[model samples]
Target: MKMQRRSLRIEETLVKAFIYFSVICVVFALFNILWHILSHGVGLITWEFISSYPRDMGRAGGILPSIVGTACLVALAVAVAAPIGILTATYLAEYAGKSGVMRAVRFSIDTLAGVPSIVFGLFGFAFLVIFCGFRWSILSGGLTLAFMILPVIVRTSEEAIKSVPYEYRECSLALGATKWQTVARVVLPAAAPGIVTGIILGIGRSVGETAAIMLTAGSSLGLPTSIMDPVRSLSLHLYILVSEGVSFEMGYATASVLIILIFCVNLITNLLVRYMITKRMGAGAH
Candidate 1:
C-alpha cells in the first residue's frame, strides 16, 4: 500500500509539472510577440502619422493611402471570390457527382490550401499582372487574392451546407420540390451563418497577406483612385517599412493597428455569430 501511494504521488507530480511547463511556454511566446509589437510601434502612432502618407519614407510618415488601398483590395477580393466560392461549394455539397472529376476538384482545393503564398505571388506576378498586361492593377491583385481565399471559402461553405439537417432536405423533396428548389430554399438559408463565417476567414487572410500581394499589388502607397491604377496595402507597407531600414516607430504603429483591425474583425464576427445563435434560440422558443 505504501509503495502504491508513493508511485501515485510521483505520477501526479509529474503530470502537474508537465502542465505547468507547457502553459508557461505558451504564455511566454504569446506575450513576447505582443510585447515586441508594442515596444516598436507605440512611439510613432500619432494622429498625423495615421492621416498622412509616407513622405519619402520615415518614422513620422502616415499610412492613409495604404489603409485606403488595403481596404479596397480586401473589398474587391472578397466580392469577387465569395459568390463563386459559395456557389461552387453549393454545387459540390448538393449537386456534384461523386465521380473522378469531382474527386479531382476536391483534391485541387486541398492542394491550393497547402501551396505557399510566395509561390502564389510569383505566379500572380508572372501570369495575372505581367503576362496578362494588367500591370499590377487592382484587378490583378484582387483576382490573385481571390484565388488565395478560394480553397478556404469552398471548404468552409461546403462544411456549413453539409451541417444542415438531412431531414430538411428530405421534407422538401417529399413535398415535390425540385433539387434546385430544395437547395435554394432549405439548404442555403440554414447554412448562411457558416458561409458568412467562411467569408470572414477568407477576408482575414486576404487582408493580412504580405507575400501573395507583394508581387501582384505592388508598393505605391497611395490612395486607390481606380482599380486600373497600381495600389498599396497595409501589410505590404509594413513589409517595406521593415526592409527599407525605416524606423520602428511607424512599423510598430502599423503592427498595432493591424492587431486592432484583426481584433475588431474577430469581435464583429463573434457578435454576429452570437446574434445568429440568439435568433435561432428565439425561434425555437416561439
Candidate 2:
C-alpha cells in the first residue's frame, strides 16, 4: 500500500510538471512572436499608412492596395470553392461513389489534397494563366487558391457529414423520405456547423498561402480594382517584405496584421461554435 501510494504521488508530480512545461513552452513562443511584431508594427499601424500606396524601399510607403487585393482574393477563393467543396463532400460521404468512374473521381480528389502547393502553382501558371488564356490575373490566382483549398474543405465537410447522428438519418429514412430529402433536411442541419468549420479552415489556409499564389497570381503590389488586375495578397506582402529585406519595418507591420487577423477570425468562429453547441445541447435537453 505504501509503495503504491508513493508511486501514485510521483506520477502526479510528473504529470503536473509535464503540463507546466508544455504550457510554458507554448506561452513563450506566443509571447516571442507578439513581442517582435508589437515592437515593429505599433508605430507603423497608422490609418494613413494603411490607406497610402506603396513606394520604394518601404521607408515611406503603404500597403493599401495589397490589403485590398488580399481581401478580394480571399473572398473570391471562398465564394468559388465553398459550394463545390460542400457538394463534393456530400457526394463523398453520402454517396461514396460506388461506380468505377465515381471512385476514380474520389481517388483524384484525395490525391489532389496530398499534392504540393508548388506543383499546383505550376499547373495554374501553365494551364489557367497561359494555355487557358486567363493571364496572370487576380481571377486566375483566386481560382487556383479555390482549387487548392477544395480538397481540404471537401475532406473536412465529408467527415462532418459522416459524424451526424445515425438516428437522425434512420428516422428520416423511415419516414418515407427520399435520400435527397433526408440529406437536405436532416443530415445537412446536423452537419451545418461542421461544414462551416471546414470552410473556415479553407479560408484560413487560403489567406496564409504564399508559394502557390506567388507563382500563379502576379504580385504587383497594386490595388486590385478588377478581377483581371494583377494584385498582391497579405501573404504575398509578407513574403515580399521578408525576401528583399528592403524594409524590416514593413515586414513587422504586415506580420502583425496577419497574426491579428488570423486570431480574430479563429476567435469569432470559436465563439459561434460554442454558442451553437450550447444551443444544440439545450434543445436536446428539452
Candidate 3:
C-alpha cells in the first residue's frame, strides 16, 4: 500500500510539473514575441506617425487614415453583429431545445466558423461589393467581417447563457416574472462578462484581418468621409509595406501600433466589464 501511494505521489508530481512547464512555455512565447516587436518598433512610434497620413506608399508618412479606417471597420462590424448574434444565441439557448432546426442551424454556424477568411473576402467582393451595390468600401468590408465573427459571438454567448443557473430562472419565474423578464434581468446580466469577452475576441480578429479587408475595403490611403468611401486599414498598410518591399521599419512600426491598439481595446473593455459586475454585485448586496 505504501509503495502504491508513493507511485501515485510521484505521478501527481510529474503531471503538476508538466502543467507548470507548459504554462511557462506559453508565457515565454507571448513575451518573446512582444519583446521582438516592441524592441524593433517602439522607437518609431511618434505622435506625427500616429496623427498624419502616409506618403509615398507608406515609406515616408504616418498612418492616421489606416488607424481611422480600422476603427470604423471594427466598430461597424461589431455594431451590426452584436445584437443579431446575441439574439440568435438567446433563441438557441432558450427555445431551440433538441430540434432538427437547431441541429441544422448549429451545423451551418460551425461551417461558417471553419470557413477561411479569404473565402469570406471573396464572397464579400462578389456579393456586397458587386451584387448588393455596396462597392469596395467600409460597408462591404464591415458586413463581411460581421459575417465572419457572427458564429464566434453566437457560440460564446450561447455557452454563457447556458452557464447561467436554472435556479435563477426558476426564482424569477416564481416571483411572477415573465420569461423575457427573467432572461433580461437575470440571465443576461450574469452572462454579460462572457458575451463581452466574445465581442472582444471578434474585435481582435477584425483588427488583425488583412486579406478580407484588402479585397472588400480597398487599400486607399484617403480618409473615409462616409461608409461608402474606400479606406486602408493598419493591417493592410503593414501588409503593403512588407509585401511590396516599401519599408520594413514602417511595417514594424505599424505592427507595434496594431498590438498597442488591441491591448488598449482589451483593457478598456475588461475594465468596463469589471465595473458592470461590481455594480451588479453592489446592487444585489443592497
TM-score of 3: 0.87
Residues 95-177, candidate 1, lDDT per residue (tens digit)? 88898878998999999999999999899999998799888878888888999999999998998899787888999999999
TM-scores for every candidate against the unseen true structure: 0.90, 0.87, 0.87
Model 1 vs. true fold: TM:
0.90
Say which prediction, candidate 1 or candidate 2, comes out ahead on lDDT. 1
Candidate 3 all-Cα RMSD: 3.2
- What would the per-residue lDDT of candidate 2 be over residues 1-286, giving only the tens digit for each residue? 9999999999999999999999999999989888988788877788887899888845567889878888887888999999999998888788865888678877888898888999989999999899888888888899999999998888878877997878888999999999999999999888888788888888888888888888878988767677898888888887887887778888888887787788877886787678667866776786
- Candidate 3, residue 152: Cα displacement in angstroms equals 1.6
Q: Which stretches of candidate 1 lie over 4 Å from their true place?
A: 1-9, 39-44, 276-286
Candidate 2 positional error at 141, Å: 0.8
Number of the candidate with higher TM-score, 1 or 3: 1
Which ten-residue region of model 1 has the weakest summed lDDT? Answer: 277-286
